[model samples]
Target chain A: MSANPVSRARLFGSAAIVITTLAALIAAVLSIGPSGLVWAGIIGAVALGYAALSFVLHLSYPDAAEAAWDEQNTVAHRDSLIFGFWAVLWVFLVFLALSLTGRMDPAMAFYWLGPVLGAVPPAHYVVSVLRGRAE
Target chain B: MTTKLIVHLRVYRAQAKLTQAELANLIGVSRKTINTIENGVFTPSTTLALTLAKALNCSVHDLFALPE
Candidate 1:
């Protein structure tokens, strides 16, 4: 049988998380200063903590780990995408409004866009879990 | 009138003496998926409905129905 769509989405989400974290880490490292060091440390700790948690969960609950990307998860992912689209659009609109009023720099608005867009999936997943809608 | 899909999955699963996790394993899904379907909180796809019916040794109609 073909792989579940939820499973595929989870794989891509995990990849996105890793890539963004790596990019942030690289950017932090390239700029050397106390602030840069602090950002790098914070990012490193978060990445390591996530990896450790996933490893432990996989080892401790093999069945749950295997089932993590099931149909329920797919439904949650789909809902999250809908939520994310609206959220991103709202953020863009707000930024556009501010830029037009000369209250915010367009470049600054664009800089914040990437992180906000990247945050949607994980934020939605957390909300779903809290609502007991997704595993 | 809005029609809701009424799922009889729990009754059949109970008759088969299978736990949610067991049925999930049989159908290659998660226990959460089985639980949600049983509670009528989530509707399974056609493919999943067929797989669940096959796993439970029943027809899709037997496992699910709409109120008349």
Candidate 2:
């Protein structure tokens, strides 16, 4: 939200990390090679580090971070859930049609469902921000 | 048939010389929350509305009003 250079730099850095990590994850899953474990380990380590940092921040800066978290949980999360509703519906409908037409397996639809639904929030956020309509 | 909620938060925020992020920090909300509330894309809860009103040095009714 802060368009200051420092804040923008930090946001871009964080986004870069997320993008790279996700790309690695997808490649790992697709290839199922030895690097898969490496990628999984990296992701696990990042998750653990993030959790630890968040715990520390919550403890140290209880008011600021917790308030933000509360707002996110109550407000942003509610919006995300609404978006997820339509996202899941449309995704399933499309996938169902694809499966019925013998293009994709029905089981794959169920398999991809959670990830696709999960992506809706970040996707919406990114698109909204890019379009300057996030507010 | 029902009228949509209209928020005059941006005017108050401008008068207070506060950016959305600054006001959000003051009221302990995410900037996105403040931005959305100002743009009328989202409405604040009662507590948040009161908090915003207090921070902006205005009454709740002064901060948010019907279009009459």
Candidate 3:
């Protein structure tokens, strides 16, 4: 099969994580006395660090599978950073609406969909890693 | 980066326990896509990778490999 753009998914996944993490921090700051948000910030920092490292690894190794980082692929990284902001805003608006309606717990602020997206089978990812292919 | 070793088309498909048709159906793509990927003529998208990885129950690393 001709290779399709694999970066887009990477972009989406990383963006989603960053956005969710940021939202968690913000919510923690505004509501639960900055401590939780501070910790969340720490986690965000860690995630960002890993993201950067992944990028470098991908560039240097290219074919290295673990180098297939969360938001590291060259093309995908940009998309994730840009789209991440937008996705978070969308999520924020959603949370805002929920808050106003008093329909859900504010703690729902964590990145929910990111993990649930486990809908995509892990088996294929493993295959891609071993095969040195994007997908 | 250096050029790396890659899997044989047949090996990868078998490892995923996927017939080309089954994988294509799951990904909402055509079997031709799977066949191409299997033949080393195709590279999948990041989205497709995640989908495949998720189904395979392993990290993308396990699926794709680098040359020694």
Candidate RMSDs in Å, in order, are: 7.3, 5.1, 14.8
Mind giving the per-residue lDDT tens digits that candidate 1 earns over B1-68?
Answer: 65689999999999999998788878768676788889888888899999999988999999999988
Ranked by TM-score, the better of candidates 2 and 3 is 2
lDDT of 3 by residue, A1-135 (tens): 223223333434344454555555566558754565465565557556556755664566553333233322333334434554566567677877887799856665444333223212232333343344433
Question: Number of the top candidate by DockQ?
Answer: 1
Regions of model 2 farther than 4 Å from truth: A3-57, A70-73, A128-135, B1-22
- Judged by whole-model lDDT over C-alpha atoms, candidate 3 comes out at 0.50
Question: Which digits, one per residue and each the tens of the lDDT, describe model 3 over residues B1-68?
Answer: 64543535456557878887666655555454555555655556668667767766666666666677
Structure candidate 2, residue pairs in collision: none
TM-score of each: 0.70, 0.61, 0.30
Better of 1 and 3 by lDDT: 1
| lDDT scores in order | 0.72, 0.64, 0.50
Report the error of model 3 at residue A109, Å: 7.1
Model 2, A33-89: lDDT tens digits are 457446556645654555566566556666556444544335554665688789889
Quality of model 1 by C-alpha lDDT: 0.72
Query: Which ten contiguous residues of candidate 3 chain A have the minimum total lDDT?
Result: A115-124
Clashing pairs in 1: none
Best by lDDT: 1
> Which residue window of length 10 is worst by lDDT in model 1 chain A?
A1-10
